[model samples]
Target: MNSNHLLLEEPIRMASILEPSRPSYFPSMTKIVGTLGPKSRSVEVISRCLMAGMSVARFDFTWGDAEFHQETLENLKLAIKKTKKLCAVMLDTTGPELLVVNKSDQPIPLEADSFVVLTPDQEKEASSNLLPINFSGLAKAVKSGDTIFLGQYLFTGSETTSVWLEVSEVKGDDVVCLIKNSAVLAGTLYTLHVSQVHIDLPTLNDKDKEVISTWGVKNNVDFLSLSHTRSGQDIREAREYLSKLGDLSQTQIFAKIENVEGLVNFDEILQEADGIILARGNLGIDLPPEKVFLFQKAAVYKCNMAGKPAVVTRVVDSMTDNLRPTRAEATDVANAVLDGADAILLGAETMRGLYPVESISIVGKICGESEKVYNQDSYFKKTVKYVGEPMSHMESIASSAVFNFKIT
Candidate 1:
C-alpha cells in the first residue's frame, strides 16, 4: 500500500484493537436517567451526575415521610437553579407494597431453608415467620402460594395467608421474606395490580403536598414517575393533584409497570401516562421470578408499539454493590439498549454504591459503542415516534447543510 494509505490503515487497526471487534449497540446520542437519593441529592452531587450525562433525575418518594420529601424537593430545586443545568426531576411514589426496613441499619443475613415470620412492625426483629411490614393493604393483596423474599432465599406459601402474629411474640422489628426465589434486597412484599392501588390516594398527606406542589410549580419538572401504578385511574389521580397547583400541562407522567395487574392493564395505563417505567425489582415479586424477563420484554415491545418512551429501571447493576459488575450484567445492560429502551435507569449504583461515577461512565461507553453498529436510527424512530416524526420533517434542511459542508 502507498505510505498515505498505510497511515490510514494504522489508525483503523488501532481503533479496532481499542474497541470491540464486532458490531455494537451504542448510539451516537443517548439519553441518561439517574436516581436521586441521600448520596446524590446535594448541589455538588447533582452537578456531578448532570455533568456525567444525567438527563433525568428520579426522585424516589418512598423512603421518607412527607416532610422529608419536601426538604429533598427544595434542595433539588435550589441545586438545579444554582447550576443552571438542564436536568429533569422525576417524582416516584410507593404503591401498596409493604416496604420493610432492616433495623440493623445494614444488610442482614438470612440462612437458607430457615423458618421466619414477618410482621407489620417497623423495628427489625428476628423471627421465623413474623416480620413487620407497613402496607395496610398488604393483607388484602397477597394470596397463598405467593413467595416472599429476603435476599435470595425463597419461601413457598403453604396457602393464601395473612396470619396475624402476636406483636409481643415478635422478637425484632422486621423479618425478611424470600419471595419467589429471587434475590431479596431491601424491600417489602405485596401483590401487584395494574388498577391503581390506592393507599394514601391522590391527596398529599398533611402539609407535604404543599411543599412538593410548590417545587412542581417552580421547577416545572420534566416528568413525574408514579411508582406502584395499578391503572389509568392512578395516573388520573396524580394528574388531578398536580393540576390543582398549576397548569402542569408541559410535564409528562410515567406509569411504573411493576406488577401483574399493571401488565394486564398496560394498554390503558400507557394511554394515560406520558411514558412507562419497567420497574423489574417489584415486578419480580408480583409475578413468577422466571417470567420477569419475558414480562420486561413484553412491556418494552408494548411500549414501543404504543410509541411511548419506556425506561428500564432497577437492579441494572445490583451486584455492583460488592464487586464490579459481572459480564452477565454488562451483557444484560447492552441487551436492554438493543431492546430499544429510551433510557436505562441507574438506581442503587448511583444512589449508594462506591463506583457511582464509573457506573455512569461505563453505561455511557457501552451505549456509545453499541449505537455504532446497532440499528440505532431504527430503534429511535420506532421508540421515540413523536420526536422522530418532527425531526424527519426537518431532516432535509440538515441533510442539505451536510451536503454543502462536504462540498466545501
Candidate 2:
C-alpha cells in the first residue's frame, strides 16, 4: 500500500485521548469567560480553570482596588505560563452605578415602618437610622414618594434580604425615607437602586477612568466590559479615553445591555461596540423577569447577524454552591449555545463559587454537545439574508467563507 493508505489505517490510541493536557484543547467554538475572585484568584486555581477551558479572565473593578487586581493579574500571568494557554484579560468597569456605604463591619438592622436618613456624604458613618449613598446627586435625583431598594436582589427576583425605603422628604443633601420592611443590611458596599428615577451620572466615573488609564493600560488589557451601557456614545467615549491613555488599539469595547435604555438604543450600541454582553442579572432588575429572556434572545440574534461576539452571563448560578447544575441550568447553557452565543460567562459561579473548574468543564461540555445539533447552514442563510444583497467587502468575504465551508 502507498504511504497515505498506511497512515489512514493506523488506529488512534486511547492513551493519547486521555492525555492530561487534552482539556486545554477546547471542544467547542463557544469560549468560556471566568471571573477572578477570592475563590479562583490563586495561581493553581486559575491554572486549573485555564486547562478546563477558560478563554478569558475577567476582573471586576467594582469590588476590588488596583493593588488587589494587580496581584490577581500577576497570578493569572503565572497561570497562563504554567498552562501554556493564551487567555485574554477583561476589565469590567463600575460605570454609573449607585452603591451604599456602610461604616460598620456588622449588619445594621432597620425596623419596619422606621425612618432613616439617606445622605450622600461619604465622610458620614452609616448607622441603623442613617444610610449613606454614594451618589452625590441622590437628593436631587429622587423626590418624595420615590422608592429605593438597598440590596443585591432588586427586580430580578423575590426580595430576600433587601430593604425597601420610600422617600419621605428631601432635606438639603440628605433624603429621609421610611423603611417599608424590616431587614438586616450587611457588607461594605451595597447596590442602591431608585425606581423610575434617572440619575444623571457620568457613564465613566472618576474611579473607572483612573483604573482604565492606570491598571488597564499597564496590563495591556484586551477587553473593556462597560457596565450599564446606555448608548453608543458610551462606547465611543470609552474608546476615546483608551486612545488618550496609551496604545490600546488591541483593546475592544464590549457594551453590556443591562437596562431599558440600553435595550432602546441597542441598534446604535451594537453598531459602535466591538461586542455585546447580555448581563442578565441587572437586566432582570431593569425589566420584567419574563422580558429579560426575550431581550437576551433578541440581543444574541442581533449580535450574530452583526457578526460580532455575544457573551451570556449567569447561565448556571445555582452551580455556585452545588456540585452539579440543575436541569434548567443545563438547558440554559445548551440554549445559549444554540442561540449562537459566541461565549458563556460565569460570574459568581467562577468568581466565588466552590466549583470553578467544574463549572467551566460542564459549560464546555454542554456547548460542545449543543454545537453538534446547531444548524450551521440555516444560520448562515439567515445571516446572509440579514446582510441582504450588495454586501460590504467584509460581509461578502465572510459570506464566501461560509459558503465554501458548507460545500467542503
Candidate 3:
C-alpha cells in the first residue's frame, strides 16, 4: 500500500481493536461560581470542582474568620496548581446586613404570643425573652406595630425554624416585640429584617472595610461581590476604598441586587460596577416571590445591552441536599442561561451541600446544552437596537463587526 493509504488503514485498524471512546465533554461559555465552605474547602474537592468547570471560587466573609479563609485560600492555590486551570477568587462582603446573636450557643424556642425584647446590646445573651441584634440602630429604626422577621421566611427548608416578631413598644434602646409565631431559632447567627422599615445603615460597615483592607488586599482577590448594593454610590465607595488599599485595579466589583432599593437603582449601579449578581434568595424575601423573576429578566437584559456580565445565584438550591436537582431547579438554571446570564453562582449548593462536585458538573452540563438553542441571532439584534445612538469608538467597531458577520 502507498504511504497515505497505510496511514489511514493503521488508524482504522487501531480503532477496531481499541475500546470504545467516551463521549466528548465541552465546557460552557457561561462561567460557574462555586462557594467554598466547610464541605468543599479541601484541596481535592476544589481540584475536582475546577475540573468540573468552576470558573470562580467565592469566599463568603459573613460566616468564617480571617484565619479560616486563609487556610482555604491556600488549599485553593494548591488545587489550581494541580488542575492547571484558572479560577478567580471572589470576596463577598457582609455589607450593612444585620444578624441575631444567640449567646446560648444552642437553639432557642419561643412560644407564640410570648413577649420578647429585641435589644441592640451586643454583650447581652439571647434568652427566651431577650434577643440581641447586631445593628446598634435597630431600636430607633423600628417603631411600635412594625413586623420583624428573623431568619429566612421560606424556600430555605428552614421556614419552620424562622421566627416572626411584632414590635409592641420601643423603650430606650430596646424594642419590645411579641413573638408572632412559635419557631425555634436554630443557628447562632440569624438574619434580622424589619418589615417596611428602612434601616439607615451605611453601605459599607466597619467589618466590610476591615476585611477588604486586610484579607482581600493581602490575598489579591479577583472580584469583590458587594452585598445589598443599593445605588451607584455604593459601588463608587467600594472602588475608592480599594484604591486607597493599594492597587486593586485588577479586582472587579460585582454589585448584588437583593432588595427593592437595589432594583430601583439598578441602572445607576450597573453603570458604576463591572458586573451584576442577582441574589435571588434575599431578593425573593424583599419582594413578592412572583416578582423576583421579572426583576431578574429586566436586570439581565440591561447587563447584556451594556456588555457587562450578569450572574444569577440560588438557581440550584435544591441540589444542596439531594444528589440531583429538582425539575423546577433544572428549568430555572436553563432559563437563566437562555436569558443571557454570563455566570451562575451556587451558594449553599457547593458550600454546605452533600454533592459539591456533582452540583458543578450538572450545572455546567445544563449551561452547555441550553446554549445550543440560545437564539443568539435574536439576542444580538435586540442588544444592537437597544444600544443605538451615541456609540463610543469601541462600541461602533463591535457593532460594525457584528453587522458584517450577520450579512456575510
Candidate 4:
C-alpha cells in the first residue's frame, strides 16, 4: 500500500463506480389536473398551465352545455397538439342533484347569521329564506345542534336534521349552506340529489348525461368523473353510457367519494371505477372536518393498495380566493401526496383565482418536493445492480457483464 500506488488506484475505482448506467429510470411526475373555466380556457392560458406541468385538464360537466363543452374540448386538443404534449382531459358529471342558485354572473356573497332552508324546489329563491335542496329527508336529517358552513362560513339553526339555519344576512346567489353532520352533503357542486331518498338506480341527470355523451364522442376526454356516486351500480351505469358513446378504450372513470354511501361501498366502487377522487368540499360536509383528514389518509392508502390512482382535492384557502394558500392548505396537499395520491386536483385555485398560474405552479412545487421525499429510498434501490431473468444462462451473464461494463 504505497501512497503513490493508492492514489493512482483511487482514481480508477472512482471512474468505474461513478459511470452512468446504460438505462436509468427517473421518478415519474405526479399528475396535475387543472379545471377548465372561462378565465382559464383560452389557448394561451391553457398552454401556460401545461407548460407549468399540468398533465390533465378537467372540464366540469356541471358548468356549460354540450356545445360549450365541445368548443372547449376543441380548443384544449388544439393546444395539446400545438405544444406537443399528451395532456389528458377529464369530464366531471353532475348527478341528478340541484345547487341552490343558477350560475352566477358575479361571485355571490353570504353574510354571517343567515337562515336558509334547502328543499326540492329549484324556484326557491334567496327571499324564500328557504334554500330548497332536491334531496329527500333533508329537513328531517338536521339535528338540533349542527353547524352548517357555506363557502367559508358556518350556518346555525334548529333541531330537525333535515333543516339548517343562521338568521341574519344579505344573500345574492351565493352557494348556500355548507351543512355539517349529514351522511350525505347538499348544495355544492356534486351535492347529493337523493341523499336520503330511496332512489334505486344510478341517477344520471339529463343535462349531465348529454354533456358526458358529447365529451365521450369528442374522444379528447381521458377521464369521466362521476359525481355523487353512491355504489358500484353508479360506476357501471356511467361505464355503459361511455361505452355507448364509444369512449371505453382510453377514457377512464373516477368515482368521487363524497358521501356516506360512497365511503361505505368503497371496495365495490373501486372494482368498477378506474380511480377515486376525494372531493372534500362536499365530503367534509358529510363527515366531521377532523375526520376528513383521517378518512383522506385511509382513502389514499386504500387506492394505493388497490393500485388505482387517487386524487385529493378542495384545498380551499384564502389564497384560492385571495393571493396565496394558507399554511393549512399547503399541509393538506403535502399530506395527500405523502399518503400516495397519484394526482392532486386544482379547482377554484384554477377556476377563479387571481393567480391561477401561480396557484398551479405552487401546487407543482409542493408535489415535486413530496415526491422527492417519498421516493428517495426507491431511487437509491433502483441504482443497485441486479441480474435479470434467466440468470443461469452464459449468454445472459455475458450480456449483463457487457451492459454493466464490469469487464473490459
Candidate 5:
C-alpha cells in the first residue's frame, strides 16, 4: 500500500437521490455488488452506490484490520438507514491464503530472468533478496514449470503487468524461482500464487474464526463469502463454525472459485454452498487467461440451472483509474447479463477507484440494456436442458444456456 493512498477522514452523508424523469434503474435479474473501502467507505459514496444500482456492500477482510472493517460496517448500517432500501452486507472472510513480503522497505523491481529465493519464515533476509512466504513446504511442492503471480488483484490492474515467477531449482527450504515476467514490486506485500501447486492449508485461520464468532455474529451479516474455497468440506467447516455461533442460518455462504483446486472440486462445493462467485482474478492465475471467459460462462450457466445466485466479478476493472471504462469492460458487463449472472461485483474498481458510483451506474445501465434484448429461448438454454452433468473448465460460451436468474 502507498503512504499516499486515499482514506476517508470523516463521514459526510448525502440524501438518496433518484430522479423519476430519467429512466429508472431497476436491476434486471442480476444484482450489483460494490466493495467498501477507503474510496467508497463514506456515507455519501455508499448512498450513491445504492442509488446507482448496488444491492450488496462487501467488506473485504484481506486489506484492513478488524477495527477498520468494523467502522465500515457501521457506516454501511447508516447508509442503509439513509437510503431505506433493502441491501445485504457481505463479510468476505480471508480464508487460507499466502502473501509475498518484500522486507527490504523499498521497491524490489526484478528484471526478466531474475532469480528470487522463496523462504517460509519472517527472517529479515532482504539483503539476500529472499521473499518471505507464510505457509510451509514450498521447496518440495512446486516443480520447475510452475508459474507465480505478483498481486491479489480482484480487477483493474493489468494481468500481463502482474509479475510471475517460475521455479527453476529447489534447495531445501530455499526454493529458488526465476522471474518469468517483470514488473515494479510497488508495495511491501506482493501476493504470490504458485503454478500447479495446491496449497494445503486450513480453511479458516484464527482471525477468521475470531471475527465470525464476535463481529459477524453480532451484525448478523447477510452473506459470508469464503475465499480460496478448495472443497465442499471447507464450506461445511465454515457452516459448522457459524452454526456453533448461532449465525449459520442468518448468513448465506458464498463460495469463491479462485484456484484450480476449487474448480476440481466445484461440483461438491457448489452442492454445499448457497451461492457462487466466479472470482476471475485468481481464476486467471489458476487457469490460463484464454480459458477465463469459458469458466465464467460455465459457472454462470451451472449456477443458474441449480437456481443458485451466481455473481460475475471483475467486470469493470478499468474504472480503477478512469471515470469511463473501456469498450471491452462495458461489453463484459453486458455479456455477464446475457450469460445470466445473478450479480456482478466491483472489487478494486469500487474499493479504491475514483469513480465508484459511476462504475456502478455504468454496469447497471448495461445490465438493464442487455437484459431487454436477451432471448428467452436460446440454443444454449436448450443445451443446458439436454445435459444434466456439469460442464468442463473450457466449456464453449456459445452454447452456455442462460437460465432463469433472479436476485432477491
Candidate 6:
C-alpha cells in the first residue's frame, strides 16, 4: 500500500449532488451595480460601465431635485439603447431619512464622549448645529442609552457610513447624546435604533410617493430599492402606492435593511421584497462592527435559499479616490461572492468619484475571480450551512444529503 493513500474499491456512503446546473452563461457571474450620478450619467460613461460588467444603474433620489433625477432616467434609457446590453434600472428612494439641522456653517465634528443635542422640531432649521432631528416625537421616543446613528461621511467618499451616539439626556423636545464613538462626521443625517419607539414617521414620505408614482411605475423600472426598510408593512405600503399608480407587478422591490429593527424583521421583509440589499454603510452603525459581517452573511444566505437575488452594498467605498482598493476591501468583495451575493453596489464610489471607471473595472475583475470558486460542491459541503427554513421535507432531505457527500 502507498504511504499516502488508503485504497477502497467499493463505495461506502451516499454522495449527494447539486440539482441539474441549467445555468445561463454570462460574461460575468455576479452582477455589478453602479449608481448613476455626475460621473456615470452621460451615455459614454454609462456605456463604459456596461462594458466593464455593470448590470444595473441605480438612481439615488437623495440628492438633486426631481428634474435632475428625471434627466438621469432619460439619459439612462438612451445609454441602455446605445449599448444594446441588457441592464436593469434601480430607483433607490429617499425613504424616511432622518437628519439633524446643522446650525453651524460647518459640519459638527465629534470626538469620543462628546455631547450633542437633538431637538424635535422639523420646521426650525436651526443654524446652531445643536442637532435638531426631523422626526417628530423623537425626543420623547429616545430614552437614555438608546443609540442614534449619525450616517457620517467619515470614510473618504462613502455616503451612508455612520458612527454611534448614546443618549445621555432625554428632556422635553430635547435629547442630549454623548458620542459613543469618535468620528469626524461631515453629514448631518441619522438613523434611529432603540429597543422600541413610538415613531410617527411615514415609510414613504410625500416626496417618495410622488417619485414612485411619476418615475418608478411610469418608467417601469426593474428594481425599486426602498431605503431603511424597517418591516414587511413598509414594502406592502410601497406596493399599494405602485398599484394605485400603475400595474403593481411591473416593478421588483429590493428592501434595504439598515438597522436592528430591519434585522429583526428580515424574514418578513424578504417575503415582500423580490430582492434585498444588505446596505452596510448605515447597517455598520446599526450593529457593532463585529456583527455586521454576520448579518450580511445571514441576509445573503437567506436570499439564496429563497431563490432571490441579494446585493451587498458599500463593498469598496474608499475606491473613490485611489484606483486600487485596500486589501481588506478586496477580501470583502471576495467574501461577498463566496457568501452568495448575487450583486454588489457602488454608491459614492461611482456616484461622484475620482476613479469611477477604474473602480468598476477593478470590482468586475474581483467579482469574476471570486465567483469562479464561489460554491464548488466540495467547498459547499465543507463550510456551508443554510440558515433559511427549507420549504418542504424533500428540501430538508436534499439539504442534508448535500452536506453528507464524501470527499472520496
Give candidate 4's TM-score: 0.71
* Predicted model with the maximum TM-score: 3
Give per-residue CA lDDT, model 4, range 1-408, as digits (tens): 787787686523445435543221132367888887776777888777777777888887665667776777678788898877678878887774444443222333333344345455566453324444444444444443444443321111111213333323223332234333332223333223323333343457777776666556656577888888889998888788777776555678899987777888988998888999998866766676788888888888777766689998876445455666788878777777888888988876776555667777777776766665575344223333332344457756765775677335
Task: Show where candidate 3 strays beyond 4 Å.
Answer: 1-24, 152-157, 389-408
CA lDDT for candidate 3: 0.86
lDDT of 1 by residue, 1-408 (tens): 687788775523444547553332332255678776666666677766666667777766655555555566577667767767677777665545444444544333334444455655556462334444554444443443344433321111212222222112223433333332212333333232312233443323433355357655665777877766778987888787777767566678888876666788888898899998898766765577688888778777777777689788653454335445667777777777677677888876776565665666567666666555466456545655644554564665775676588579
Per-candidate TM equals 0.70, 0.87, 0.88, 0.71, 0.85, 0.80
| Cand. 6 Cα-lDDT | 0.74
Clashes of 5: 2
Q: Evaluated with lDDT, which candidate comes out highest?
A: 3
Between prediction 5 and prediction 6, the one with superior lDDT is: 5
In model 3, residue pairs whose N, Cα or C atoms come closer than 3 Å (at least 3 residues apart or on different chains), thus clashing, are: none
lDDT of each: 0.60, 0.85, 0.86, 0.63, 0.78, 0.74
Ranking 3 against 6 by TM-score, winner: 3
Collision pairs in model 2: none
Question: What is candidate 6's lDDT per residue for 174-287, written digit by digit as tens?
Answer: 888887766554544444444334356777889888887777766788888898899999999888787777654678888998778889999999999889998887777657
Output the better candidate (3/4) by lDDT: 3
Tens digits of per-residue lDDT, candidate 3, 1-408, equal: 687788775523444435533222578989999999999999999999999999899999888899999999999999999999999999999887888888778888889989999888979888889888888898888778887878743224357778878899988989899998898887676888675466788778899999988899889999999998999999999899898887676789999887888988999999999999999877877787898899989999999989899999988777777899989988999999999999999888888888999999999988887776678779977876887767789988987897899689
Better of 1 and 6 by lDDT: 6
Predictions ranked by TM-score, top down? Answer: 3, 2, 5, 6, 4, 1
Q: After best superposition, candidate 6 residue 134: deviation in angstroms?
A: 1.3
Question: Residue 4: error of model 4 in Å?
Answer: 30
RMSD of 3: 8.3
Model 1 / residue 21 / CA error / Å: 11
Q: What's model 6's lDDT at 383? A: 34
